[model samples]
Structure formats: structure tokens, C-alpha cells
Target: MLQTSPRCSLYLVTPLLSAAAANAFGEIFAEALEAAPVACALVRFVSGSEAHAAAIVAPLLRPARSADCALLIENDVRAAARLGADGVHVAGAGEDLAEAIKRLKPDRIVGAGSLSTRDEAMTAGEMGADYVMFGEPRGGAQTTGLASLVSLTERVAWWAEVFETPCVAFAQTIEAAGTLADAGADFVALGDAVWAASSPAAAVRDAQSVITRAGVGVP
Candidate 1:
């Protein structure tokens, strides 16, 4: 589970990486972490066997831990266990999530994403997900535009108002981080908004500024 924070925090999500890219990204990730207080980071890899994925993820462990950032593996529980990642993030709120929780609970964080409805989100919370993410693009697609952002903000507002379980809201751009924070998300996830920037670390600083500004009087 995420540590409680009085204000919304940053959650970093890497672009899908290959083993060769992981080493370079490790440097970039460390730079971004220095820009602000990130609550956690989820590392996604290009399709590969679990052992291969674990090999790709291994080099990142030290950087993440040195920064006190919880590192999460996307969708592979076995790799996460093998690499001793801080947690695993299951893409759907179903048996995958349930099994992840059953296998790793009390020792690892299991977050749920790809929820399409209130019912699914509720089910994930009931099953003890460490956090439920909203607004993440499905299947490596580009970020959906304004309509999805509006819907995401609304869902985040509703969840913050009604639920005790922590919520993570994906922000497609640095500016959107503020909107989600104001909507009461406990953490705002940054993907393309950070990694696509010319200076990923600078983008992270900008995002932290926006979230801080939005958090004033947010309660």
C-alpha cells in the first residue's frame, strides 16, 4: 500500500522498454526522481518471457530504492517476485488482481488499473488493491484527448469523495497533473508528459509545481 500523504504525489510510469533501453532509462529515471518526491514508479516492458522481463528490470532496482521510490512491475507477478520489486501492478480488476493480492499481500503492493466502470473499481477495492488507477490509456495507445480527461476528472472526484482506498489518476500532460490533484487524486501518474519531454527531469519539476499549487485548500 502507498504511504499516506497530506497532499497528492507524483507517480511515474515508464514507456514500454526493451532490455537495451533499460540501462539508459535507468539514468533518466534517476534524474527525474531528483526533481521531486515521487510516490512510486511502474515499469512496463515490451513483450517478453517473465525471466527476460526480470532481467530487464533488475538494473533499475538500486536506483529506485536509493531514491526511496517503490518500483512496480507491470502485469508480471513472477518477474516482480523474482526481481523483488516493491510491488506488481495488474492491468485489470479481475482474477489477475485477486491472485496477485493472494500471492503477494502483506509483502508487496498490488495496484489495479484498466477499470472501465465504477463497479470494477469497487470490486478492486474490495479485493484489497493498494491503489486503483484511472485514466491510463489501454494497450499502449496514445493518450485519449479532452473528452477522456473530463471523464477521468469526474471519476477521480467521485472516488475521492466516496472512497477510502487510495486513487491514482493518469495525467497525459504536465498541466493535467494539477487538474487531477484538484479532483482529489492521491497520486497523479505521469507518462508521456514526462518521458516525452525534452527534459524529463524538468517536466517532473513542472508537474510537482502544478500539483503543489492545486493542492492548496484541497483538503
Candidate 2:
């Protein structure tokens, strides 16, 4: 069995916003995160095509960070450690994940992102991932409906139980987030709904309340 960290946490996905507004959006999240209770902040640094994304994101990983993904460089792993970020997640298959695990400790949270198929998710689990980030269930076209959400959640939950690997639920809206939480998601990852709201902080606060009300509050 792959070793799982005690800090397998409540992962919060960063809200999507205009790249031109990324820094300011980050600040909004940073402030809300500082106040809102959560286990970690998952930033998509290297997910982009920037040379310094890791250097830019590592500082955010330290104090207020619990889990994370996409450390840009081998050097960035050191930064993650320095920042006291519990985990450094990797995305994709045959990705240089081994190098990351080798660089960080074995128990560090090294998550795999965007596994759209069971085979893909299982492969990630077998390779010793701390968690497998199942892609969003329903957010596009006819896919964005209550039925789709329920169906996808059931499938993801089944996989999580079978593999004993935690599932990270990414919701596009507030109601969707609540549904995921109530559906027994281990960690709920919400974005756009809160950050892009007219009142980012207020929206997040309401989200915090809803998550708590749904009995999904992180310890």
C-alpha cells in the first residue's frame, strides 16, 4: 500500500480569473484563505507556460498552505519544503512524478491531476500517488446538469473507495460545491463561484458556511 500522509487535507482549488487579473485574484484568495479555515491552497503555477511560476507560488505555499500541485522545477521542490507546504502534486501520466517523489519525502502529498478515466486514476494510485484528482464531472454543454453531477460523483466515489485514494471534488458553483460535499467528497475544491463573485470575500464566507452546514468542514 502507498503511504498516505496524516495531513491528507481539505484542498481548495484556486479560482479562475483573467491572467491579467491573476495576481489581484490571488491576493483576494490569499486574504480569504488567511481568514477562511482550510487545509491547503492548490495553485496552478507550472500548469501554465511560465519560467518562474514555481518561484512565484512557493511563497504562498508556506504558512497558509496544506496541499499543492505543479511545482515548476527541481529547485521548486526545495522551495515547497522551505515554505512548509505539505505536498507537491504532479499532473499527467509518466510525468516526471518519480523525480518529484525522489526529491521530496515519500509521505509528502504528491497528487496527480486530471485523471479522466478509471484506468488513468488507478495508474496514478498504483504509482503511489497520495491522491488522484478526478477531473470535473459536469461543467460543460449537456454535461452541466444535476444528473451529470450525481452520476460523476457516484463514479468518483466508487473509485475512491475501491482504491482507498481520496477524491478531490472540483465544483464550478456554490450549489454544486454543496452537492459534492453532501455526497461524501473527501475534499471539496471550489473556484470561480467565490473568487469571481461581486464580493469575493463575502462569497467565500458564504461558501465556508455552506460547507460547514453540509458537515464537510475540515479539521
Q: Give the best candidate by TM-score.
A: 1
Provide the global lDDT of candidate 2 against the true structure. Answer: 0.56
Least accurate 10 contiguous residues by lDDT in model 1: 138-147
Q: What CA RMSD would you report for each candidate?
A: 2.4, 5.6
Per residue, candidate 1 scores C-alpha lDDT tens digits across 1-219 of: 777598899999988888888889888998999888898999998866454785678778888888899999999898888788989999778889989999999799999988878888999999999999987844445333324678889999999999999999998889888999999999999998899899999999999999998957643
- Candidate 2 per-residue lDDT, tens place, 99-173, comes to 666767564567766565667777877877766665442232223222366665775567655767776666667
TM-score of each: 0.94, 0.70
Which regions of candidate 2 deviate over 4 angstroms?
Answer: 1-10, 15-23, 46-49, 58-85, 136-147, 215-219
Number of the top candidate by lDDT?
Answer: 1
Of candidate 2, the 10-residue stretch with the lowest lDDT total is: 66-75
Taken over the whole model, the C-alpha lDDT of each candidate is 0.87, 0.56
